[model samples]
Target: MLVDADDCEIVGEANGSAEMERLLIESAPEVVLCDTSPADALRVIEALSGEGAALVLLGEDHSEYQLMADAVLPGWAYLRKEADRIEILGAIRAAGAGLIAVDRSFSLLPGSAFPLADAEILPPDETLTAREREVLQQMTHGLPNKQIAARLNISQHTVKFHVASILAKLGASSRTEAVTSGARRGLVSL
Candidate 1:
């Protein structure tokens, strides 16, 4: 587990949002470290917000981009690759303590608009659990519970449980309703 002596645990690593989502669901890490393209990073953070893990975004340059991403969740930390170990460790500790730790570069762009600050459009109550989201995603494909269970390697009862949870979470009365609701809410597409 010793990738470095400074960090306590390696915890988990993810190549993309989908895999990150899985790891987060299973391990429930205290923080998530992601180095993603600017556009994709915003979407990933938005999708992963409900899990309570502080987000730490790592990349180089793009002060404005960091501002945009930081605005999504003030508790997140944005650090540059050139930052020293002390700074990096400090950011990690700050993020773990649920505080915002924006890179110093962002201060230079003081007048720059935090583009994503007011860009998130979802209602506060609309977020769904990872499982409910999976069901809704399957519903988007017009898949039946049996088919979904087979695909997810879960029992049919578990699939039914997920479907029920999806319906309740999405405020839909049926699978079709759930699919439509999910699509409209940007949770799924068909």
Candidate 2:
């Protein structure tokens, strides 16, 4: 595919990290587009860390989006190599503007989850009170405040307080975010 070479300047290309590092220092481009597997992408991402040029990775495996998205930051994205010229170009433009452009194929929206490996586990919140843990357990069952209060034999006000504390400890802005974060940390199973 020509990818309409006229759309943007092709600074340079490299086969691996060593060559890419040299090209990065020499060209100092605004955004770097890489076509590689998720494993290979990790090496390039590490090499380009703090190098100033934003990255747009085009990985071959769709299931690796989580591992790749874990590396997400301003102007950093994981797109599919099968992305068309428009999608690729749009990602490049977004990267240059310090914005992220996640691939449409990924179901990575808020509250969505991908199975996590044990080695990639997040830190569990050890600061939660026993009562707070109980509240979180109820939350995983989608219990409303009134129901939770009934189950825990606590006042609705007390339930709200525990919920607020749970959110704060999990660094989540919403109940769903809290639950997702909680599950990721093995605080709750859902």
Candidate 3:
């Protein structure tokens, strides 16, 4: 599909890890499309790291949440195989332009209807400390630092510290992103 896209140029395709490595080193394309196994996709992400090749990972029959969590850096996309052509191409373009794109298969907005799945979006690795989790929950309610400190019976300075910790643990740059990620991981609710 990417080969046919007007915005993309087909460089090389790989059938195995060795070939993929060769193609990556040789072609060094602006974006990498991966629709294979999760392991191979992870490898591709690793290979492209610091090389400026954005990754568009298509999850079919794998643990998508885990893969998405592992796709931590900017310029990474995690889309379901069911994504339409337009969605796929848009994600690739966005990633290529150094943006993080999450598939619409799950609405990850702050108060979207997307359910907290049976399992967490990320489990232990992104786990927040007890106090950090409290701050995150306050953040879910859109509480400011002063309000959170008052509610949690802590100093505003302490609240700020916990907020920073929550953002770091969740890999979020802002409070809203932390809340959304926390909701997806069943750590917080809207």
Clashing pairs for predicted structure model 1, backbone only? none
Model 3 misplaced regions, further than 4 Å = 61-74, 106-190
Clashing pairs in 2: none
Give the least accurate 10-residue stretch of model 2, judged by summed lDDT: 107-116
Best to worst by lDDT, what's the order?
2, 3, 1
lDDT of 3 at 160: 90
For model 2, the superposed segments whose C-alpha errors exceed 4 Å read 1-7, 62-74, 108-190
Question: TM-score of every model?
Answer: 0.50, 0.56, 0.55
lDDT of 3 by residue, 49-70 (tens): 6776788877754344344445
Of candidates 3 and 2, the better by lDDT: 2
Q: Give the per-residue lDDT digits (tens) of candidate 2, residues 18-114.
A: 7899998899877888887566777787766677788888876655545544554447666777888778888888887887666755534333334
Estimate the Cα RMSD of every predicted model relative to the unseen true structure.
17.6, 7.3, 8.1
Of candidate 3, the 10-residue stretch with the lowest lDDT total is: 108-117
lDDT of 1 by residue, 31-140 (tens): 77677877677667775576677777776655435453544344677777677767767777788788866676653343332324333324567567677777778878
Give the RMSD in angstroms, all C-alphas superposed, for model 2: 7.3
Which candidate comes out best when scored by lDDT?
2
